[model samples]
Target: MAQAAREPDFRTRLQEWIPKLVLSPSVAAMVVFVYGFIAFTVYLSFSDSRMLPSYDLVGFGNYAKLWGLSAWWTAIVNLGIFASLYIVTCTAIGLVLAIFLDQKIRGEGMLRPIYLYPMALSFIVTGTAWKWIMDPGIGIENSMHLWGWTSFEFDWIKDRNMAIYTVVIAAVWQTSGFVMAMFLAGLRGIDNEILKAAQIDGASSWSLYRRIVIPLLRPAFLSAFVILAHLAVKSYDLIVALTGGGPGRATELPATFMYSYTFTRNSMGIGAASAVIMLMTIAAIMTPYLYAELKEKT
Candidate 1:
């Protein structure tokens, strides 16, 4: 009878402590900082506000104006450019680097660190460096002339049509290292015996990679592709630092546009609409990848 009474006490104690155990302080922090912030942003989006939050509700006025803006259009166009360039350049360069580094290479340990070190730097630093290097009058081309490589002309930063490419280049310089690491990790997982068998079957190095190795790295490629795509979609910081949507708002992107509205223009309603659009765009692009990730997890 005493043992039976102890069981009830244990159950009662467990019930009382369950919430504490399940909802940790870290979890509570996520709720307050992440989920709570998302909720606040969403709530603000539905309201009519300027400079500060106003509870007076206005429906879709912000959305209409945001859609009508030419700066917004430029942002949409540049987003496409940024995504296309970043995905293609990063994947191609990263794959090449991974394959080269995978070879029985001299100084590979040092080389790998050299490639990956850029990832440790923030975009602010990267942007500053790139701005200097690509500066029309004072940068590489000017120095090249000093070195007698006078035929070279590297002046993309000042031209409106070409400034966006400079942004893409800066982004790739910073991010390709991360993709290289991902590809290198994938390469390590591949069996060397399979590669030897391919060589025994008279496959050239190019043929071996194209036919066997590339296909095997699909999961890694998919993962990296999604990551790069998400980064491209959300890109703003590097562009802001490098160009500031410059030369008549030529390099504008969605996030930057939202920022312009929210802070610079003090059009909070339009900014909120842009934010919602950004969320929707990301969701639309990610739905397929998200489904695959979920299915794989299960």
Candidate 2:
């Protein structure tokens, strides 16, 4: 009887301890891999690090230098342009494609693969193919001239003013198809009966789709927007393959800037500062949509 009275206290202790025991491995791994490494990076960011990771305390001296750097400033401004164009173009084109394909048209099976196959390939392939096709030496530009159009100059890749748009073209090619797939799945899940009822009420196709279909796909649009935002903010590979921040750094983006600072320049402190700044920027940009998404989820 006395042991039974003591059981309650033991059980309470056991319940409290079980969670720690259960979480021990994951916690350990996160500390070692995530938090530990992040802390080390942050520490390095404060010191005057170099080729071999110097540890002399320099306070925020590197950040002061970073803030004044023209390249960094250019990269920040250019990144904003890249991301805005990417998000807007991808979302608009993807939505249009998705709505068109939702008509249940014939040949969709074959066309779908052709449209989406670009996504299966790496950005390396996308960049290379696009670069070649737009190559000034022997691409569509020359091909167009070959076809008797004497003055067809499609060479934005080399233009300082318009190079970033070329990168966005490649990005949209890869990402828009994926967005279309997302919206198509959302469309399929929607009720056809609602459309039929709308039709019975003498609703025009434009009004029915606009007033009904678009509103219902809010979840899909919101989801796509969040994803596109994330991708745009951190986009690196395609830009590297396409331009390498080229034509006198006209296409320099935040990701490429971070890499150049960290690896090429051996400025670890500055690099970390850039990375943390990028994190803050991404969080700021995506927080509103993310909050709405979470509210919906809960």
Candidate 3:
């Protein structure tokens, strides 16, 4: 009997450890590739490396020079515009779509997919498609002219002063559907009793949303902001695909700036510094949300 009990105990212990053993390799890889590389990049930011990695430490000098560069400042300002407009437009459009869909409208399933289809495509595809559509020679402008609307001019993609807004437009189109889904889920989760209670209290539709429903959706709002802000900061591929940092430095964001300096310009130290700044920016946005989530769980 003692032998039988020992056999079952051993089996149970083995079962408990099997999942951990399976996961150990992935965890180790993440530590080495993700976190290990991050540490190395941070170290490089402080070194005198150029064109390649060097171990000679130079303190914060790289950071100082990085800030002094006009290109870096241009990227920062462009990011400000792009991030602000991208976040606001996506949120607004998403909220409106969510509210519209929550009314139990006909063909709901069909409409939801139609709205979300853009998100299914890769950013590269969206950017390339929009680029063709916005190009004056063979895109909308040409099509309009062919249709005899000679006065129809929509060549903003080639205009330096208006180029950054084109990036905003493409980014918003790709992301708004995702934000809408988040909000729709939030809306669906709201208690119908609460909405009915407000309705019975003589509250108008606008008043109900303004005073109660919107406030209750605070979690969704916070989540949307965090996700959008993170995306805005790290946005790279879309800009590269759409504008290629533009007719000039008009749409050059920090990510592009970092790549240009680090790899192309042989200013690896500056690039590393810029990369660290980007990492810090993401951390700053993420840290608060994480703390709040952990605190709430506890």
Candidate 4:
């Protein structure tokens, strides 16, 4: 009898331990790779590191230099433009596509995948393709010239004044489908009875959507905003592939700024400072939303 009881207890403990054992490596990886590096970066930001990390503390000198740099300011300005346009454009396009798809359209199963296909490709791929498509000498402009529309000028990728908008365009193209999927899920989860009741109450389609349906998609909107904002903040690969932060740093973002300073410019301490600022910016946007979400769940 004691042996039988011991066997069951052992099995129960084994089941619990197995999951922890499976999860331990991932947890440790996060702790080390994510949190550990973050802490180390923070330390580097306050030190006098240059080209290589040094433990000598230099107070806030790096941050002061980072702020005073014209290139860093340019990156901040570009980020503002890119993030704002990226969020608004993606959200608007996604909402429209979701609403269109929600009409019980024929071939939705086929069409949804078509819309989402761009997201399957990495940002690097998207940017590289857009780079070719937007290049004045080889892309749309050249193609237009060949097609006998020589006046066509779509050289925004190489134009300093308009280069940042190109980044926004590529970002929106890649992410809007994902946002649409999120909103579509939200739309489908809405209570159909409420929609029917609203329809019966003589609500026009516009009024019904404005008053009831769109409001119900608040969670989806929040999620999309957070995700798009985060993507916009950390957008290095896309910019590298697309503009290489070129046209004289017109499309430079903070991520690129950090990389250039750390690896290329050999200003490691200032780069670390820029990285810390980027982290704080993301935390500022995320902390409140996460708190509210967790609070609601509890």
Q: Using Cα atoms with residue i matched to residue i, what is each candidate's TM-score against the true structure? A: 0.90, 0.86, 0.93, 0.92
Model 2 superposed RMSD (Cα): 3.4
RMSD of 4: 2.2
Model 1 misplaced stretches (Cα beyond 4 Å): 1-8, 11-24, 149-151
Q: Please write out the lDDT profile of model 4 over residues 7-39, one tens digit for every residue.
A: 989999999899999999999999999999999
Q: Could you give candidate 2's per-residue lDDT for residues 1-298 as a string of tens digits?
A: 9999999999999999999999999999999998798778777778888765777889988889889999899888888788888888887887888889988889999888887888898888888888888777798899999999979899889999988889888999998988888888888989999999999999999999899998999888888888988888788888788888887898998889989989998877888878777777778868887787789889
Tens digit of lDDT per residue, candidate 3, span 173-246?
A: 99999999999999999999999998999999999999998999999999999999999999999889998998
What residue pairs clash in candidate 1, if any at all?
A: none
lDDT of 1 by residue, 143-216 (tens): 99899998988887888888889999999999998999999999999999999999999999999999999999
Point out where model 3 deviates above 4 Å.
1-19
Q: List the residue pairs that clash in candidate 3.
A: none
Q: Where does the lowest 10-residue lDDT sum fall in candidate 1?
A: 37-46
Candidate 2 is scored at a TM of 0.86
lDDT computed for candidate 3: 0.95
Candidate ranking (TM-score, best to worst): 3, 4, 1, 2
Winning candidate number (TM-score): 3
